[model samples]
Structures are given as structure tokens and as C-alpha cells.
Target: MRDRIKTDELLSTSDLRVSTAATAWRHVEAEYVDEIDGILATLAPSGPYAYTVSPRMEEGKEIPTQRIVTTFDEIAETYQNLHRFAAVVAIRPVTQLHASWYTFVSGLGRGREKATGQESERPVIVLFPTMGSEGITGELFWGRTQRDSMPGDPADGSLASRFAVAKVHDTLLDAYRSGDVDALTDLAHAEIQAGLRDYEADTGTLAEMHTREELRRHLERFFGRYRVLGIDVVTSHYDDWFFFHELRWTVESRTGDDAGQTYRYHTAEYAELSAEGKIVAHIGHGTDRISAACPGPA
Candidate 1:
């Protein structure tokens, strides 16, 4: 299809149906591009809240799996995101085709109802793409349940407490990703303890990064080796006085000679706050499933 819109001309949609009709615009890749690079948006004549991810199908599986690749939106949207989430995934078409398949969809996280603004889990769309004799074939799943949840009611404790931890959550995330050890130490207490591991793979008890100095050195070493490409949020929520977040991230190596090699990884982090809302303990687990081939090595 000769149809192509410069990224600037496109208005992000929240009601558009993602289907064969969108194939012509497959070149319309969003910055939020995923697997097959198919174009997906959420919009419809009904309103801005409607979302759809295409090749609507009855039964199928996501290929390479859908990982949270960015979290800025989750934190930016403040607990209500599903109504406006967007994503793309790779999948083998339910109807086999000689051509390759890819999908683009919107509405990954959930939004809250209007009357109460009380948040509840909502479904996001997953769309698929396929090439056929007729051109492009579509597969889609509707009402796919979402895993992210909003912070619990402040009535359980106090708005001050909830907001404090939420803010701390934001701050600590910033520090962790930026490798700002000084910021981490300032946010965390003197006795702060940190643990990191992989949820899907057991690498052992993790390094004993119990002291601020250890944490600083560990982060410095990590930042020295890999350059973070991007980070996506799979889930971000708060419970009691604790905050937790799961991320799907991509990082490229900058150390040694494999500087350009990229690795896809996922991690979950949990942090508990002291009575004063200072982070006391932080634990993280990560996994790198897909092996990346660096041109230089064996």
C-alpha cells in the first residue's frame, strides 16, 4: 500500500478498529512499535474510550510474548491507563497464510468509571495481522483482562500516606533506572536492603547489596556495562504501605566489544516504606529469556 503518514500527522486514536482495513497503513508504525510493526490505535465513532487491537480471533497465542516495554505512561497517567493503552504483538495467524503476520492494538491498561472515579480492572485489546491472497487478514481479542491496578483507597489509611509512597515509588523508579545512587540513598534509609533476582529463572540468592555503598557500586557497575534503551511498565500498583512495579525493558551493551548488542529483559520490583515513608527494603527479580546474538562473540 502506498499509504503512509508521517508520524507527526497522525492523531493517536482511542476508538479506531484495528483490522484488515489498517493493513494499508502498516507502515504507520507508532513510537510504541511492537513485534510485527503493524499499526494499531484505539478510537471509534462512539468515543475516545473505545479500544481495539486487531486480527480479531477466537483463539490464538501471543508470540515472543507481550512484555511491558515502557512505564512512563503508567506513572504519567496516574493509575487510569487501560482506556488509553496501546501495544503490538507477534502471532501466527489462526488462519495460516503464506505471508507473515503482525498486530497493533491499543488499550493495554484499564481506566476507571466516571461517576466514582473508583478504579477497577478493565480489558485491553490485542490485535493480529496476517497477509492473505486478498491482501491483509485480521485477528483480534476483545476484553482481554488487564493486570495493572490503581492504588488502593486512601481511606484504608490516609491520603498522605498513600500519596507519599506513590511519590516515593516514582522517585525510586527514577533513581533506579537512571542509576542515581545518591538519589536512591537519599530516598532509602541507612539500613536499606536491596535484593534482585529473576522470577522465571533462579540465579541464586542474589548479591548481598545490603549497604548503601554496595548498592552504589552495584549500580555503577551495571550502568557501566549496559545502556538502557527503553522500559515499559507491565504493572504498577500500591498496597498498604508497599509499592510494586513490573517492567519489560530493552538495553544495549556498551562494555567490552559487544557495545551494540541488545537484550530484552523483564523485572519486578517491590519496595516497603518505613513509617516516615522512607524506603526501607527493596527487592527485585529479573529474567532475560530471548538470547541476543552479539556480532563479536561466541
Candidate 2:
């Protein structure tokens, strides 16, 4: 029931166009385009977005040449290696979605947050999609993708509770960005549970502090490590018990062996708030983008 969005009218299938005239390609192209139009009609009709088609690429021919492909399964296989996907063909967008060509690329992946589309400071709902076993099936296989960063409808939680934690979030975010260690320390309760620093590795505790001074010491080094910075709130959720976030940010090292390095990192945080609105238990986790050398001007 949740997946079924109510729309007054379905987007016209004839409105979409594919570059290829091949019957084989048309079969799959129509399917993909229709799915997108359904999504737009319900969630973002006339919204900013893009759709692109890329043909299979070959060697020893012109720099930009399309090779013949018989089935849609080929596209699924190539999606595994992103470079190979690009090499397969150029990505262009449906002209109506975006006014400028550049915006289309940004929406596709050139510079997306890999989480929720909303900007900073908005409370996000934690929702995932569920499908039935009755849709047309195929050999299509796409490896797990963070590309579907946009969440579905909001999960179960009251807005009042979310706002309660958001107040603290705003303060913590502001303090961290401004490098105000004292203010950050004051925002937390005397006791803390620094969650796994590397959530993926699942190592030991990030930091377990019983006093504000201890948190302050940790904050000093943590906050001082970065110079120029950027933050984007991808998807977020409040499940009645805790407020959580999946986010990405840009940072340049300031002091340490890796001092000059720049990183675009993905992180998540789960915070437990007390009656007084101070963060009592905080779990922080994230990993740096090794491939993203240094974030530059956008």
C-alpha cells in the first residue's frame, strides 16, 4: 500500500524518446522511461531531473561510436563497472527535465550527495521500497547501489519528537562547522558513547567519555583536523527512539601526516537525546573517499 502513490494522471508514454531505432532497444527503453514517468507523476511532477541513454561502445573505431547490442541485460552487466558504463556510451538527458545540460549530469551522478536530495537541516524520513513477486521478470542484475539515495515516504515517527532532536542537531552542526569545541562540549551530556568511528570496519568504540573535559579533548583533535569544509544532509530519519542521518561532506586536512590531503567522506550519526535536549549518547561513523583526492570548487 505504501509503494502505491496516488496520481491524478499518468505521464504520457509517447512523451519519451530514445536515440535508438532498434526494436530490441525500444522494448527496454519504453519500460525504463515509463517507470520514471510514474515516479515523477506522483512525487515530483515537472520537477528538476534527467534521463539519458548510452549505447554500447567499441574500440578501433571513431572516438564516439555505438556498437550493436541485442538485449537490455547487457546494460545491467556493464553497470557493475562504472568506468565501463561510461566507456559503453555517452550519457545525455531527456531535454524536458532540465534547462541546462550540466544540471542533468549533476542529478545523474557527477555531483550528487548519494543520500537524500534535500539540502542541509531538513528532517528526513527513513523509507525503503518493497516490490511484489508479480512484475515482469528478467535476467537484469544491478549490484547493490547507493545511487538510490532518495528515501521513500517518511517512516513511523511524530514530527514533534523529530523537531526536539533537530534543535540539538542544528547546534551541534553549527558548533562543529565553526570549530567551537567548548560549545560542542556543552551540547553533550557528561556521559557519551562515541559510536564506531569506522562503521564498516566495525572496530572498537570511537570514543567513550564520562566527562565534558574528555569530550572536549576529543573534539579538539577531531574538529582541528579539517580546514575548508562542506556538508550536505542526504537522507535522515527519526524512528521515535533516535535521530539518524546519512550524509556527505568535503574536508581538507589541516594537521597530521595526512595534513594536506582532501577528502569527500560519507558519514552517519545516531544520537540519543535527554530530557533537557542535550545529546547523551552519540554514535559517529564514516569513511573517506580515497578516490576523491581533494574537493575543489563546484
Candidate 3:
């Protein structure tokens, strides 16, 4: 991804297949170069949100993880300071487990070393949510920065260690990829519903499914339109409340003007589980189409 992006252009899609929260985040990053005021407008004025950094090891000593509670003003100020020496080179919106929030992975470029001119990048995971009346009055921010050298979570008694949440996720994807409605039904909460509000689109326009049946029908239509070739999980983390993952997959159009063509997409997703371990909600924050090819063999 480029260091700078034109978000306004991407938000013009006539439908709500994409995410508003993710798009809003991209807008914030894109405006950092020219509109500090715009950045402020998108965030909540005050906050007690948690911001954590992944732990790293150096010289055989661990740089223990750290966290803080901060406000939007502090965040904005930090962004201003960073503008002097860094740029947001890439953004990958991850799926979120909460309806009001979103999460994403970002790459910060700190420019070349003064002497060696060697470039370096930092990876950051941000969790942000909008709150208040109309779900638009303000926004809250929280994040965890994962350094390039940070090690994976150590074995512990966390929920991830006690439950096979990642396996549940894998099964969910397998169900979808194989068009197994029975498996999909078994995995979802009865009242399961999902959506993304497209504030940029015409008012009253929404992309949502209100019940398990609705979700089923929607997937049936989708499966009819595209043949899912395969899905590969790139990375994932599971906790008590959410299962976060990154995936890359390819598909071929089944019946359409583009039939027979193949397309590949990379996405980040979040899933919420019910007490019975079924998925209560699943949100897709964003998807980036990485490539497309001409008609290919089945």
C-alpha cells in the first residue's frame, strides 16, 4: 500500500458492501498530511480507553508490555508529532466483534536511517469506536502496537488456551467455502445479525441481515454468484470476547458478465461467540482485492 491514500474516492461505492468504520479510519490517515482539524473531528474529545503495546525481547531481557488510558487530544497531538518524521504507509482493516467499534493493522514508515538510509516500519493494531447520539456524536480510540520483533503470546491460562476458538473460526470458514448450510446453521446464534452503515451513501440505505435465515439466503445468493476456490488463514488471535483473523482467498465468478474470471482478496475479520461457543456476530471491516485474472480453468 502507498504511504498516502485517497479515501474519498473509495467511499463512493453505491452499495454498503464495504465498512463505514474502516473507511472513516482511512479518511483519518489520508487527512493527516493536510488536515489536522479533520482528524480531531473524527475522534471523541475525552477518553479512558486502554492502549497497549505488545512485548518484545532484547538482549535476552523482555521489554514488558505497557498500557495507558488516554484521550483524543493526546492522540491527536501524538499524530502531529509523528507527522514530522513518519507516514502511514499501509492500512488493513480487521474484522471487529463489536457493532460500535472497528480494528485495523497499520504500517508506519519512519523514513530511512540518517547514515545507512535503510527504511524501517512499525506495525500497529488499533481498536476504535464511535459513540453517543445517532452513533455519530464522537469516537473513542484504543490500540496495541506490535513491534516487528515481538514474539507470539506465551502459553498461559487465557481463554485462547482453554477454548478452541481458532478451530471454531476455521470450521466457520470451511462451512462457508463449501456451501454447507447445515454447518453454517450449527455455528450461528439463532438471532445472529450483521451489518455496516454506509454514512456516505444515501440515507436509509443499509447493508444488513436481521436473522439467521436472512444470512443463509444472502450466502446462497453469494455462492451462486461466485465459486469460492479456497481460503487460507494468514494469522489469528483468539480471546474471551473476540476471534481476530487475517485471510487471503480466491474466487471465480459463477454466473455474470465476469464469469470464469478469478479474483483474489485479502481481509481481516472479527467474530463474537455465544455462551455455547457458537458465533453470535461476525464483522468484516475491510477487504482489499489484491489481484484479478482472465478466464481460467475450473
Best candidate (score: lDDT): 3
Residue-level lDDT tens digits of model 2 in 30-132:
3344343332222211211111123223464211221211223333333333333222111222211111000111012121222343322221111110111
Q: Which candidate has the highest TM-score of all?
A: 3
Off by over 4 Å in 1: 1-157, 198-205, 289-298
- TM-scores of all predicted structures: 0.43, 0.42, 0.47
Q: Tell me the lDDT of model 2 at 123.
A: 19
Give the clash total for candidate 1: 29
Residue 73 C-alpha lDDT in model 3: 54
Between which residue pairs do clashes occur in model 3?
Answer: 95-268, 95-270
Q: Any idea what lDDT model 2 has?
A: 0.40
Candidate 3, 104-216: lDDT as tens digits: 43333233333454566543334343322112222222222212211223453454432566667778888867878778877876655443222112122123454578667
Residue 14 lDDT, candidate 2, scale 0-100:
22
Candidate 1 TM-score, C-alpha based = 0.43
Instruction: Give per-residue lDDT, candidate 2, residue 92.
Output: 26
Tens-digit lDDT track of model 1 for 112-144: 444455544333333333321122222223333
